[model samples]
Target: MPNVRPGEKPEIARLPLFREMQEEQRERIFSGSFLQVFPPQLTLFELGQHPDFLHVLIDGLVELYATSAGRDTTMRIVEPVTSFILAAVVTDMPYLMSARTLTSSRILLVPAALVREVVKQDCALMQATMRELALAYRDMVRALTDMKLRQSAERLGNLLLQQERRQGGNGAVQLKAEKRLLASLLGMTPENLSRAFAVLGQHGLEVDGAQVRFTDQAALEAFSRPDPVKDDD
Candidate 1:
């Protein structure tokens, strides 16, 4: 279970858009935001639902996915200090993907109408929002390019490399999410993930349960052949 708390005005004020806004604007936005906590696996919202709030993740992870033909495909993982489904909220359209908690999480729900109002009145806020949207679009493009150009094994290798980077290039890294979820995020089946791991083993990647230790980082990187243009950290 997750614990809920009153929304902290300072927290909302510190966000990029709010930070740039005037004090009155910041207060107005904060006044309408509410803080909530959610337990793991709780669905925050469903696909095709009208956007009501701009959900800002203060802590923990949220998985964004879409279902088609009864198969769920993981789209993106929302990390802290970020908002999800912003385009939908801004456009007053239904969400294209569903979101759920990956772990116990703290989130702030800012009313979509309020956000739209502020954006309309504040030029700086509008510019900041446009910048965020552009970056998000670029990230989506990179992800699509990665999926199209790389094999599943290579994708897994790049993911491990990213984890290693997060750990300050340490040789050892631990999987934060479950293997099944990781497989989905990488656009592969559990069986395919297993095979990818096996293939990586020959290139000096060692996996023992959730922990992964790279015996030879150079060899692994060489095998993965990651392209910086297609892969972003």
Candidate 2:
């Protein structure tokens, strides 16, 4: 069972899944949820652990990673105002990856039992959950397609471009995670990532420690060959 406490839950109201829920249903959800805080590098749960709560990251960063044998790879880094592990909660299954905070975070924990019960009773919630799941599936397919079709350098180039866009169109990017994690996320060894960065420099991509930049956006884009389906965050 998850830790439950009495408190405010205004953050839950902003979730798309709850937007269309009836007032009564929303109250039911509110009554069963609680908020918790965690520091950076704290592991929220390990892979294969059963879902106890549907975590909504109201603030800070969460990294979802998976381990195989002795090696672990970053699966995704989640930003604020999003719900994670919803599929696990709805299906009453184990988490496919482990989650840890990359920065101090405040999370809303809605009990799994309540979510399961409410989702079954609330048609709107059910529809929203299905739509979220479908979007996740499509994203996974797009990520896989990019991995299969692009070379290591191209993958890293596309990622830098995506980050630049995330930081606004200023042609500047500050990587949130370390190079090792970034390499794993891009499916490359650290050495390969270094080589890729060196390659991009010739095309106007600049790397200064953790910051990447490019004033000649056209040149960089020409090398990266940006594709929306693969590059959109």
Candidate 3:
């Protein structure tokens, strides 16, 4: 329902196949596809649900989570221009995670059979798909490793520093999601997150609410580095 339509400028189409394919190939992929729009907080699929289509996320963020015995845990957040429920689509398994829209989004649905057809006929598409899956796996491994190897406060500090880097030096930074979600993503409880902020300040992180200013950029970066410790670990 939000402004999910392609703007005046030519849209990238958000599919690796779409980008590499010729017009005919593009047409083939879209032959029987459908575009659906969803509002923010919309749940597209629940955990353990069977995935019927290979969904290409054209716009907006999707939060993936899991629930068991009435307990829900946020897993990851997918930004626009990526596939949602990719693991299920690729392996023909029920979704291990649920996807909910973090903002208004437009999704392109391609039948799984047609997606397989494209993979077979188009070598580039197949390769790109493999690369995407591999990268996703690598990221999961890294996240797991970080969690296992770092303390909660350190992990939260690193997450904040990474976000600052992503936003090009932390001026007017935004979380892009609620604090609870962010806390989950960092593998810390909300109260722990608050303590992490205080810890960072003790270690020289300047925090003014959401807009964290760095009193000493070099000191902060050094502390955030993998092999260094400033005042404390």
TM-score list, all predictions: 0.90, 0.90, 0.84
Residue pairs in candidate 1 whose N, alpha carbon or C atoms collide under 3 angstroms: none
The lDDT of each candidate is 0.86, 0.84, 0.71
| Residue 78 lDDT in candidate 3 | 79
Q: Please write out the lDDT profile of model 2 over residues 43-123, one tens digit for every residue.
A: 999999999989988888999999999989988888877789788998999999999999999898888999999988999
List runs of model 3 lying over 4 Å from the truth.
Answer: 1-14, 169-172, 226-233
User: For every model in order, what is the number of clashing pairs?
Assistant: 0, 0, 0
- Over 4 Å off, model 1: 1-7, 230-233
Q: Give the TM-score of candidate 2.
A: 0.90
lDDT of 2 at 102: 92
Of the two candidates 2 and 3, the one with more favorable TM-score, higher being better, is: 2
